[model samples]
Target: MKGPPMPAPLSRREFIATSAAAATLATIPVVHAGGSDLLRVGLIGCGRRGTGAATQALHADRNVRLVAMGDAFEDRLEESLATLLRDKEVADKVDVKKENRFVGFDACEKVLASGVDVVLLTTPPHFRPLHLEAAVKAGKHIFAEKPVAVDAPGVRSVLESCELARKKNLSVVSGLCLRYDWGFRETVKRLHDGAIGKIVALRANDYRGSNWGKARQKGWTDMEYQMRNWYNFTWLSGDFNVEQHVHFLDVCAWVMKDRYPTSAMGLGGRQARTGPEFGHIYDHFSVVYEYDDGTQLISNCRQQPGCKNNISGHVYGAKGH
Candidate 1:
């Protein structure tokens, strides 16, 4: 199947009007069916985010228990479990035993098959499509992190999984926290009420730093090194644009009535983040996305250190901003 193309440096416009997001939470309340008064939860990709997500879920409901955990690295899985078990807030809700902790690329599938009613897919974006597909097939409700896929093929897989989840009456909650922010919600609501009049121009920035990567260890192959420092690689992390700047991009899409841009032209480069340890991701990017009606959304993202930082969006309208 044909997929969305990477933004090429062309004077011509290119249409990419599909939704630039993953499946959001179901409007209907998600009901758990593991057992009476208990929600068996599993966590895959046991990283900082994975641990945090599991903690949040446990805190969200007393009946929820984290029963399984998995990660591509055993160290990651162990550290996450150790941290979660040490935390006072939701420590009691974690029930992952040695047998239930899996490691390797197929670890997520093991967690899904562990008879958990709910699964938190906090894996890297490259692994998300595969994990989601497995979780849905296993009849588990999902709590997935944002930037669900790294490429068009992965996105396609996620879309198919979302459809399958819907048919199976499963809930799919993404980690797009902006959607739940009251301030953003109110602003969007008022914009619809003509507070911003007609939104004629959109601008956003994701200027920040600390896109860090570890130096390769002495006894590691390229595969081992890249897996440990996935964030710096395009294949694993989709570069910073998709991995980090997707937040602003998704917000822009949301503000534009959840419709994607008709076309885009962009330029970006490695710049100061140019080193073997940092892998191959560009440190800065600037893209201008055009809608069907010719309105434009311009975006800029930079990850170099010492740069003045800002994470903000603006909607300029004919009447007001």
Candidate 2:
């Protein structure tokens, strides 16, 4: 006997329109309407952000259930599960049995095969491309976090996976939260509506202090320590530029009507955090991106401690100051 018919893939125009309209939290699940009423959601990272995304997913729809979880470290997975269980709002929705709790490097694969309709890809940016491809191939809806990859190749892989997901009629939502924020949306809309005429230049900056670091234990290998403190490693977190400053870059792109940059020159260095424990990622970055129309985006980001903190962006136009 034949199973249910597959849904028609969205046209390019339809996909663009749907993505734009569903930029906010209220409309995220609207794309998954074709799924079963009771959606079985899986968490793949089990970190702080992973746990938070799982919580949000549970709250996004009443019928959604957290059925499976995976993480490289068993402790992280168990910690996240316990935290979810304690939350009154989504506690009842958490039903990850012991068998469904997977650990180690292959945990993502295990979670994908455990009968989940949706999966949250909150692993480090390094693992995102691999996990995204697997999820798309497995025909599961995905909610992937920002800076989906560590390098150009990884980014290309994510693009390919997204296109394939489109062909499969699977919903793939990104974690660029600014796009979903009401205030930022309104502001960007006004800019695009000519509140600022003929944009000429923009400035984006994200300056902050050092992030948390875990000291290496006696028996931990290099791989174990780096994995535990993934944010400090270039291969894992993709540095603060791709990992954290991506939000500002996204905003710049939005203001430019999604135009691609023609060329860019950047300067960065590791000054404050030079210890071995901090890995090899740079602490600061400044880049100037030029568009074909001569519009420029000057961006800067830093992760140093005990310094003045400033995070803001500005757009310059012919009619505005």
Candidate 3:
């Protein structure tokens, strides 16, 4: 006789809440826009990245206002709002009220329903697909962080949402900021115009020390703890390759005018990040991405202390270095 299959390790409470929230998400109608007066903005995931995005939005335009804020934790929301208000450029445009500062697993839903024109989704990668879908369904434009998804299923959802956003005339911009830099753009343009002839090989390296990993706080559930320290988890951050190193790899692809890698073979291991707080993510990876024409892209990333770092990308061709 076969024994019972092993159960998932997630907490029952977290599972029930997540399932219930997902089931009810379909009921949120695509409602009114922020109108033509002010470009009202709401921020989800009020962490360091979220605060930075909120400030940059205010500085980018004269007609924008930070109207609402939300986070999984109330303290984070408070800190984010404080930081936003403290910045000279952002303070004048800050208009979030006490009632509009939401916190919890359902905080994103509340922020989306608050009638904002745009939303900044700087949550962990695990929440990107969910938050993006919700933002699209709520009829709001989105500026989401990188590696839009942590898995293939989430990527499928994001691709579907992108099509829907197109139909709805909503803008969905990813925070792959390197693509927007003038210098990188100019170099890529020259490379495309035959400055780099007969491309031979490319290399992308994001070797760096440990990022912002945190030890578990007291009284937090496993799920809650993981969400807080998401960068350490593969399902949350997609490892460092997709989360951080995708930028350099994409630069190589852009220079070659190829949108994707045809094949990839790689291996990775968790070296110094062996503590429980580091979760299940690897500390280093070495992958070779092959194009259809046999060109291969070498990729590597390491997140361990006391190691030499290299956060650069290179393209090699017959005519140039």
Better of 1 and 2 by lDDT: 2
**Reference-based lDDT, residue 246, model 3:** 79
Could you give candidate 1's per-residue lDDT for residues 1-321 as a string of tens digits? 243342333210111111222333222123443556577889998888888888887776556788999998999999999999899888988899899999998888788888898788887789899989998898888888988999999999999998988777777788988876667777877887888787898998999985788899998888989989999989999999999888888888888888888899999998788878899889999999999988899999999988899999989999988
**In model 1, which regions exceed 4 Å deviation?**
1-35
What is the model-wide C-alpha lDDT for candidate 2?
Answer: 0.86
Stretches off by above 4 angstroms in model 3 are 1-35
Model 2 spans with C-alpha error above 4 angstroms: 1-21, 24-36
Better candidate by TM-score, 2 or 3: 2
Which candidate comes out best when scored by TM-score?
Answer: 2
What is candidate 2's lDDT per residue for 281-318, written digit by digit as tens?
A: 89999999999989889999998999999887899999
With candidate 2 superimposed using the best TM-score fit, by how many Å does residue 309's alpha carbon deviate from the native? 1.1
lDDT of 3 by residue, 1-321 (tens): 243343343332232223112111112223333545467889999999889888877775566778999899988899888888778866988999988899998999999999897898998888999999999999887788888998999999999998888787776777877776667877887888889798878999998998777899899998889888898888889988888887887788787885677999999998897888788888899999898888878988898999998899999988986
